[model samples]
Target: MTDIYRKLYTSSMMPSINLPKHYNYIGAFLSLSCNLSCSYCINHLVGLDQRRKHLSGAEWVEGLNRIQTEGPLPISLQGGEPSIHKGFIEILNGLRKDLNVDLLTNLQFDPHKFMDLVDPERFKRDLPYPSIRVSYHPETMDLAETVNKVKILHDNGYSIGLFTVAHPDALEYIPAAEQACEENGILFKTKEFLGEHNGKLHGTYHYEGSVFSKEVKTVNCKTSELLISPEGHIYRCHHDLYNKITPVGHILDPKFQIDDIFRECTYFGKCNPCDVKRKNNRFQNFGHCSVEIQDIE
Candidate 1:
């Protein structure tokens, strides 16, 4: 039997997902299962349950191709470790040509095999940062091995870089990674750690007091990015996506659509800092927040 798939579009046709009209970004979680289980992994704290079924590669391609967005903004392939997905490269090359593609990976794959299968320009762009971002974990990863892999990919003309978390313990190693990357002409940067460590919270969040606490309150929330879970479920914020909380709808259901309106959420205090934080606006400039929350009830 030939497989048939559905498409998700506007709200009038089907179920509504509160989203901004102009989706500046889209994140497709190929799989929330990662090889290395870091203790500080926000996925675990955010209520990311691995039991959810992951969509097949074909389902992902079909679902992603149906996104009707209006911008040069790319669809980011992310997750516990996006590269670990069975069809990582296939999904990367499978996206619509009009839609730019980006990746957030740990660079644990074989680079030679990746380069031989995929073209360079698929991830290339005239941007301030590299299209492919490799995350560096000092405790769970070896610095030398990670750096070597990054250098190999960079030398091959692939637009790639390194991003390390600024954990309290890892902060001391950030400068070393940065200097190493700079010496090798690699773009190495740090991302603020979101969860609590050593009894203190890190990261600059937009909504004050919106994490870890058991407090749940109703609030109106909207997002600028298109967030998809490993099961192809679309959500309004990282809070919903990671927390296994309420999802607006599923992608490629044809019945699923973007509402482009603010909706009521009961998990306000438990919001993911990534969604509530006021951070860079793609240009690496500060003060750009991912979600706008209001009507605290």
Candidate 2:
């Protein structure tokens, strides 16, 4: 395995809970408020009844800087639309250099403004994937407009790419999108659609009944990813984060540490697809699971 992959599978280097030193991934949801309301949005799958809140840029910087890791480990800034955060630019400029930063966005923000405020090198890293991932939603996004924005960023030396979920309904449009990206010298990829569409589950999951099920069951579950909400609350999994369940810790807390152990969960059947899905690891190797669940009864 490469050094980067090794770090991902290694134990935590610092003394703070059992969080592996080379953590596989760190996801920071700057804000869950998105401009587009696609019909298949996973965030609204179970219905987010509460108003989402977000932390200021300074708070996010302070909290995220505390994280210690080595090598290719990156803190991914994502959200319903991360750029919608009030301090999006500040946060981008504020993260420590040692902490590699990646972004998942919709390419709806102003590229000129981003280029003016942020240094492109800050997002550059020696990794297999582009540092910035732009999602293309054919339903609500204009393909020409989105491609123009990506070209703007790409021309400015930012490491970026375009990804569209392979929704069954949207499959036909993907090839044309890919060809367009290729013509523009931009990387375009497709992600497997997760969750139910027309009463059928769409993705491969490790657990049998962890997604789209009406019944709930108890099970012991533990996560490998560090999922931080916009307000800095940490969750055991994506299911807990979007559903607003109690968090395991607050990133701002000086004493906060990751508890790398399994806890009992009463919503096994109602789990989010992101958490239970059997997918590729950072190395693109198949059969890797984000969380491990057992003890179901």
Candidate 3:
């Protein structure tokens, strides 16, 4: 095991809740509920036993406004389906301008409403990829319909793309979707499936035995990023936040802040592969994990 202990840099480095200083990024789960329930959905992987909490439009604006994002990085608004959030548009326009805004949706809503409500500049970016990423689920969604929506949004000057998961069952459909997207002049891409499939684990992960296993152990974990649950609670790892296994603080509280510190966790075996996996950084460069966990003692 690799144990990396260095100077705590970000506001998330404190052990206890305090004011967030250098927030690399902020994610607000507007709502965990989705319109289409894909079988391969990671949100449903651990079973939805965890309590679901949602913030109203006003509450979301208040919580999101408090975040201090660094650089051009924006607060990624995602959920089981971000569009499902009741206050989706209000929350988008409500965020402070200093804090850039991004959205990850399923394109399950009315595009006319979206275009009328959100300003294209609000999601503008100099980055290579679109600021708004829409997931296209083959089993639950029609490619033609999805593409049409993308076209409408694209024509309206919205920066967007269609992202699909490469599940084993749906692998064959991705090429077809890509072809359709190409014909329509749209940006389409596939993401590796990251869960159990036909008794085999998939996706690239940095840590061994972190997924599809029953064994558990203790370890010291540190995170360079900020993770917020749908209810506004902050977490140390994707596992603790997504599974509701544990949390450090809630953003709803005015006094809550990102406390960056190495905390002992016993659910090492249950950790989400996304957290431990060595993957691409924000620059799309290889070698990055949502969390940096080590010191397995």
Candidate 4:
């Protein structure tokens, strides 16, 4: 007797997760387990729970298909490393035809296998950033190896880019690494290191006391992001996400709805840097923030 796997719910059965008008990002945390443990990962700054259950590839496909969106924004697949998910390729192939996707990885996975299984067109999109952003961690990964993998993927039609964080410890090594990537026809960029390094906190935040400040206060916060965890739990912010705080809703629930309004947060001072960081919006505009915080109480 043969059997077929069934989806938990159909798109029709589930309510649409209407995205906000000014929403800048839609991040889907496919898996939070990384092969290389970087000390500066923001997820760990707020205490990440890696033991949480990850939704199966089919479940992820079913859950994400219910999202209602428009414009240049694509559902970003990220994590400790999104590629580590056992069903990573399947999830890529399973998203609905209308939805495009992006990936943030460390380039540690088998690129050849990825190329063989995934159609690069799935991630291709007309955007300022590449569909796949590979991080080059000099602390744990070899730069030559990273560049080679990226070159191969790029040569194979994958829209890929390489980047590194300018952590104080890692700064001296970036110039050479950038040269290597450029030599191979790969565009490399650097991101601001946003965590503690050698006893001093390093980051620029929009909120006065949202991150790295030793102050904890209550405030009304609104998010312009859809932060889904590995288990399909949607959270208000990255702080709530890494800490595994109460989620707004579960993706699989028929009653799940997205409230793009400010909600009370007593842990405002303890926010994850990602939430309060001043960064670029979807249009590549400067000075974009993921959450709006007001009504201090």
Candidate 5:
């Protein structure tokens, strides 16, 4: 479809899906296909349906534009490598200008092409973190090459940051990577490894028996973030998204509205680390978790 026609067509088709009073995030997973297959990938911590279809860029634009946030909330575009989507550039260009956007990438795409087409201002925001974050995997990527890409983009007025997971096996390499980034004046940060390595789990969780629990049980769960899959299906948490659990609604479903209430969950033990991890809330407070899971068995 032509750019002008797509813009005009997608502008006003669906009703706005408003965020709950306590909502802190909106995850827009454009695609789950990635170039690298790191052994410790969190997406595979439980299970992932690789065959799920991704929404075309036009469909994504049309559905995502219907969201209305409380403040300057950015819809985070993430994936195995969101840049792998065929219409990655087009989706980036089509979203509403007032709607802020964030990217989690592996620096796998061409930087020159990105700079040529996308305006740097599209991602710039007054926030504590950079809008574009490049996840550095020591096993799958070369550190120097990744840093070079960051330099190229940051120099061209893009607010970008380099982050690495402190995996148990790769801990030795993270220091040098951070040092390289620091010496070159690039922003470098480390994220806690979320999944398993060897025999034990690696991260702190809000709920006990949530990660790799021996037995499954039922619990009531409520989430503050809107999690959308590649196909635009809504999930209560990352576990449901990766495991292909039935979604609450599709972004394109016209009659849909935020329920803002707890829903019963059967896979309480196999919850994703991202949902249960004790982390900072939107205000940067320390004891925040994405989902409030209750009545565990």
Candidate 6:
């Protein structure tokens, strides 16, 4: 069955002729469960009532291995906290060697255990950013302990860096955290805060009235990223993923192929901030949006 799926994916999905593919990033949400619950969590922006079912480690390996990408494209492992996935280490080791791997984490796991189980070379890719990005949340995480854990990973030959969102409530602590990271020889970066804070919207978005609006509108939309849910279902955008809407395809489906053309959407005003926010592309150019939307009504 795996061989048949691989063949179908290679023949129909891989070739650019059948699917109009233009994916710059691929995200794998191993699980939506996180240990820390940050108040400004984007995953909960649309409400977190829906509990997603997760695929086994073996299933993840089979489905993900079918993906064919060029250049330094890697399948990023992330979630509420990807490390919390029961089969996290297994999935990491199970991926094909040729496929580059990147991790987005909260640095809450034991670095010693990770280093013992996983080889550093597995994540070594020639990308501009480090393979492991540890998010520093002041609200829930201890700054000193988080720094210590990142340093341990860096010392053990892991490409790691620290990123903190500049939320309105967290702004005062960010400067101090940045100084600590710099002092420790760790790369510290700040991400623009998204969502509403004290009656003000934080980040810049491409479309007007796309986010935080109560009313829903119809629009044509297309995305540049491949977002996969824990259950192996492919989503059109983050909004669909969090809202438990219909999936575009499933990774395990032999006939599943990317259709890069724009599709009609009726939930424009209730869009996730992550999809509509103006941000940098792979080339680091500003004003790149994950999804392109048109015909707003």
The runs of at least 3 residues in candidate 4 whose Cα sits more than 4 Å from the true structure, single-residue gaps closed, are 1-12, 46-48
Candidate closer to the true structure by lDDT (higher is better), 3 or 4: 4
232: Cα error in model 5, Å = 0.9
Candidate achieving higher lDDT, 1 or 3: 1
**Candidate 6: where is the Cα deviation over 4 Å?**
1-21
lDDT of 3 by residue, 11-49 (tens): 234233333443344677777778887888888866542
Tens digit of per-residue lDDT, candidate 4, span 228-296: 999888999988888888899887876678877789888977788788888888777879888899986
Candidate 5 at residue 6, lDDT?
48
Residues 1-297 of candidate 5: C-alpha lDDT, one tens digit per residue: 234344544447567888877899989888777789888888766444388788889888887888898777888999878888888889899999989899999988889989999999989776688899999999989999999999999989998999999899889998899899988888998888887777878898999889888888999999999999998889999888887797998887766688998999998888888999998776667888999988886
| C-alpha lDDT of residue 192 in model 6 | 96
Model 6 weakest lDDT span, ten residues long: 11-20
TM-score (C-alpha, index-matched) for candidate 1: 0.91
* Candidate 1 accuracy as lDDT: 0.79
As a whole number from 0 to 100, the lDDT of residue 281 in candidate 3 is: 59
- Candidate 1, poorest ten consecutive residues by summed lDDT: 1-10
What RMSD does model 3 have? 7.0
lDDT of 2 by residue, 1-297 (tens): 122323443222212333575357789999887888888988887553257667788778767877876567788999888888898888888877877999999978789988999999998888888899999999999888998899999999999999999999899889889988999999999999997788888999898878878889988987888999987889999999988897998776655788788899999999889888888777668788888898977
User: What value does the lDDT take at residue 11 in candidate 1?
Assistant: 24
Task: Select the stronger candidate by TM-score from 2 and 4.
Answer: 4
Give each model a TM-score: 0.91, 0.91, 0.89, 0.94, 0.94, 0.92
**TM-score winner, 3 or 5:** 5
Each candidate's lDDT (Cα)?
0.79, 0.83, 0.75, 0.84, 0.86, 0.86
Cα-based lDDT at residue 178, candidate 2:
95
Model 6 RMSD in Å is 3.2
